[model samples]
Target: MPNTPTTYPAGLSRREVVAWRNGIFTIFALCGIGIASWMARTPAVKAALDVSTAEMGILIFAIAIGSILGLLLSSHLLARFGAIAVMSACFVVAPVGLVVAGLAVTLGQLYWVAFAGLAIFGVGMATCDVAMNLSGAVNERILGRTIMPVFHAFFSFGTMIGAGLGALAELLHVSIALQAGIVSAVMFAVGLLAVRMTQSETVLHVPDETDAAAPDGWRSRLAIWKDPRTLLIGLIVLGMAFAEGSANDWLSLAAVEGHGVDRPTGAVVFGIFVTAMTLGRLTGPRVLDRYGRVPVLRASAVLAALGLLIFIFVPVLWIAIVGVVLWGLGSALGFPTGMSAAADDPRTAAARVSAVATIGYCAFLVGPPLIGFLGEHFGLLHALLLVLVLIVVAGVASGSARDRTKTL
Candidate 1:
């Protein structure tokens, strides 16, 4: 008689699924966690000190300063502590930063504390972001299909949920300090518990020859970054990071300063934007697989551009929401698409991806502050128009990448 065939389970184990789910939760929480303080108290923070836009710009930069420091330090931290401990550290540190920001009595104290907290938060988050993406990219390759968009979609979902929850907290007259503390508790509990729930595929899964198609060595891997096609992909990532970070840092302020929307309504701006973004990313792969990468990227860029223009040029709140939804849809695939392309392409594969990620995230470190300055020096409405120009540039870059890689 023939030997009986072996069988596998039809669905993922509760544990296997949780690892993916928890990591996504942590990423999403990062986006929405700090905003509760900023969104609820921005006006108060501004009013308490009677500070001008330039001063406010400086304060905002302080947070970025912390984030930059975090970026610089992340690789080391990840190397020393490993991903689980590092994520756990961030989950703890970020909330403490929120608590400090909420309790500080003076603006300068607020600014300095916010900076220090963000530095710590950024370290955890920046490391988490890279490790998570690297893991997702490898998993996609191993699975022989696309999963990056779905991972990102969940991140978007976390942002939406966090933002909405923050808005609701503020609306209920929860003090800013109390609101921030509440979020801190939630993120901490979630993140700490998640440590056990998530596992790294890197440890469990090794690649086959097709998976490790490139030669093995630091030199061979590093050579990927030397390729021009890979650098072009980095440019696409840079543009998208600039646009997305700008929206994250400034969208609410735009609603308040430009359109005269009240704070709670303004706070909801990113929530709506991110909610739409989550939906778009969730559905994006089907479109990507069918249409190919180029047309979808071009369409996304155009949509992002159009949304920014509508938000900047038009005054109606509902109309602006429509624009944000469109922009979210347009910009949804930027990071995932760029990374996937970098990894798939023969010229660079992984190393170029590491380079692209490094440079692209560097853009994130500076992008938001630059937006704050522009909003300070230039009119808020006028400043936002710049996002369209950047998105257009990204469109060109991604579109060209698709064309060039096809030729390769």
Candidate 2:
């Protein structure tokens, strides 16, 4: 059965609800900007550290480790302090981690410093991710509609802005330290504003009878793990995460190496993918409302698989561009919709979301190295055939996202 609707604190005006929504949206955007800023400056950092590709890969893996750790702990923290408190704490931690990473380049033990800094940043990001999504989920219940995709669109816009700024900074020969510092400062200010905006808003706590009788700590988390619905939701998200992460990590490389495109042209292809994704996310909420989640998601998964097939099989640049658009649009909805699915039961939302997120992050931890290994023998374009398999899995699991009010 669908969970009962939650009642907000009495007397919250429509304008205040709108304000709170905007604040959560801003937080999502800031999270994207912070991560993208770090990613954009990675080349500069690699140059500074003089690390080989393998060594840099290890440093990247540290972030995943930290993120998994944070995801593991977030549900308990949410159960105790609530999403706003945990999110505010993460806002502070994330920028500090960024600054430390910036300074790490100057350290004598560069690799260790970079590793530690990225690990801290990852932890902050994971915690904030859960909290922000939980907050958005609660608000969705209050408003009684689909707004999560629009919130994610703001995140995509932030990534575009961060990437553009980082590119500009690189053109000007800006130091990675200066770039990270500027991003941190700007995001911190935004975080403060978001904190204030959300302070007055009431959080809806959906009552759960099972939760009252359940043990605290690992026992509770274990129970969540044992739930089939939560596990299925996690699998659904895993597929989407792989699809999205593969594109982010490999698209430009595949374009250049596999299709014989120049680096600049390959980057333009990547931009096309990002733009399509942003447009799809911006428009997805209405699509979800009208067609509902299962049909839309199943179609998206099929479309994404088709897009990948075209991009791989068709070597021509023009056809590849068409494939990029299809893939991006297809990839946009799955992650956010999976999140909404996990949070469908408001009472168990935090635990289920954490489980789903942890599984999703596993894709990031595993996808790159897996693809890189496959690329060694098959070449990058052919290696991406693996993603098509995951997309098929996602299509099969799309029924997991059916509205709780409806029979699956």
Candidate 3:
């Protein structure tokens, strides 16, 4: 049976609320598919473009630039146009960007063209990410329980599907362009339907006349950065986002270059990581409801750190695979829990969620190039030690993510 909350958002029926939640689930999955589609094909893209790992990182940096712009723009856009409109526009933009990158890599083989496409895709993804998270937070409150992790679990499930398809494609010698075309087309079509199902309920922060900034204005939005609790939550997210994002960008490559696996096997290894993440997220809500956020987050950090250490140091392939599972389980909760923490007050949910997301995304911006440069000096496997240090920081900061609305 589906879990239903006693209360529903104003002007929405139980069916409508359920549909809205399902829509957010689809949107999250769409984002995952978009990310994994390209990420799973990274090795092939590198070969097609004839770039070294450092150069590949620079190319991936293009997505970071666009994502930053989108994150900066999200709150204001949501305030003005609302979540449905913003997400609808972004859904279209994301697929188009993916297709362009796909063609640029396979047909044109132009580095600059691929970079431009990825940047466009990044803008679409980041903006939609904030909007959907805000929407999900609202639904969580209406549902009167913690279901945020399930939304993210769907994302992991999408990655699992994408990695499976990618591995199959690689095995069958399918072109990246063709696979991207098929995947993006499916994303765009389903995404439009998903956007249509989301509720238009507003959660924009309302301010008084005495307030320094307007409710929907840039000053009010930027002011969220001043909140210490929000910043702490962002710190937690930053560490874990780096953990997950690093894997998305480099795990397959790491498996191939560091573990001496073939390309297909490397994709399979990444699939293992995604499967672990999906399981962790699927089970997260139950654990969170029982133990609360801080303890769970601390445990997550320890698991991720342990996994990273083993993955880096273990010479045995099977042992390292176990490390990947732990890393995935540990990386699963931080971002969603941080989003939930940031949105503890519905009045300020939009701005705070945007602010926290921007902070977390900084990890994505700096991580790729930093790891790549380090990998150039040290091996890719050893460079992953950087993830271990950040996981420790997240563990130390986990107390800040304790629920303020109500205790579990």
Candidate 4:
């Protein structure tokens, strides 16, 4: 990526800032690839583990547990170790977990071991997410535009790549362990390189002097949960994150079991979904800038709910693919936009980002098992109707995402 002509922050060169931005993009992309790799192979894993839908949901729940722990710890880790260090360490840990899960699934067929590995992956991935989000927020401040969606667009691009490769691997009869091992090695290498290119912690974090006299501790951090706006913004992210995470976990399965597609085709359908998400994220910045966050977010909620409904009720594969695209587009902007909203006040950015992320990620903690259990009872396609209710809640709460600092 070439350096954009922009004013550099103190002690940082244009080249360095550009590298940092590219690095953030790389990290986000890799994270997307890592998760998609797992999601694409879920059917194979379920078969290998001999788990039913409800049981598989329990397995997926491990990641959510790890993610919640990671999000909870992120702010403290950033405050103590800084973004680069936390990101670097987590990049290492995340791949190790992937390899472990791969080995457990392929070699031992060990359910508990796979669960542990996924939990480990979750911790590393979620913590790294918060750190990268904060870094991306700082980069947004530097470039002086809405670029967070682009960062997440790179993530969707990665997912598309991963899903494509996964379909190919499934078609080729490649072992999950072998695929995971190769991807994990690449993920670790790319993650480390990306972290190296990022700016130092000080460059990313600017302390607000006005808060110097305020009490600083866990108490201060906990207070962010009390803010009505933060919680509302959290609700917006929660619904959208659930909408997104549900697809990541079950979209392929829904295509396979609910819609009667083969495994490879299911993965391809998921690839289509991510491709739509990439398009949405890539184009979202201008739309957001023009319409403002509230209207854009509410509109997104409507699109997601409508797409999910079509996906649930319409059995035709082609039409369902269209529904998948709409769902992808609708899911695209919520997480990034919410992060931007939470960080509107630079002084409290770290804490608020952590809090909002924790709140939003609760969807992951609850969504998988809830959906899976519901799918078991009501059929997977019908169970998805639950997402519509949350989408409506998010639409209602869209006003919270209005940029507090700027009129737009």
Which candidate has the highest TM-score of all? 2
**lDDT for each of the candidates?**
0.65, 0.83, 0.86, 0.86
What is the C-alpha local distance difference test score of candidate 2? 0.83
TM-score of each: 0.72, 0.93, 0.87, 0.86
Candidate 3 lDDT (Cα, 0 to 1)? 0.86
Candidates sorted by TM-score, best first: 2, 3, 4, 1
**Model 3 deviation from the true structure expressed as Cα RMSD, one decimal place:** 3.4
Give lDDT tens digits, candidate 4, residues 145-170: 77899998888877777877788889
Quote the lDDT for 155 in model 1: 68
Error of 1 at 403 (Å): 13
Q: List the residue pairs that clash in candidate 1.
A: 300-330
Give the total clashing residue pairs for model 2: 0
Can you write out model 1's per-residue Cα lDDT over 145-198, one digit (the tens) per residue? 456788777666565566566667657866666776777787788767765565
Clashing pairs in 3: none
Per-candidate alpha-carbon RMSD to the true structure: 6.3, 3.0, 3.4, 3.7
Residue-level lDDT tens digits of model 2 in 1-408: 123234445566666667878998999999889888788877887888999988887887878888988999898887767777888888888888888888887545377877888888899989989888878876766666788888888898888888878889889988777787889898788887896676321355555632534566446655788888887777778887888889999999999998899999989889889888888888898898889999999989988998999999997889988999999999998888888888877678888888888888888889998999999999999999898898888889888788794556
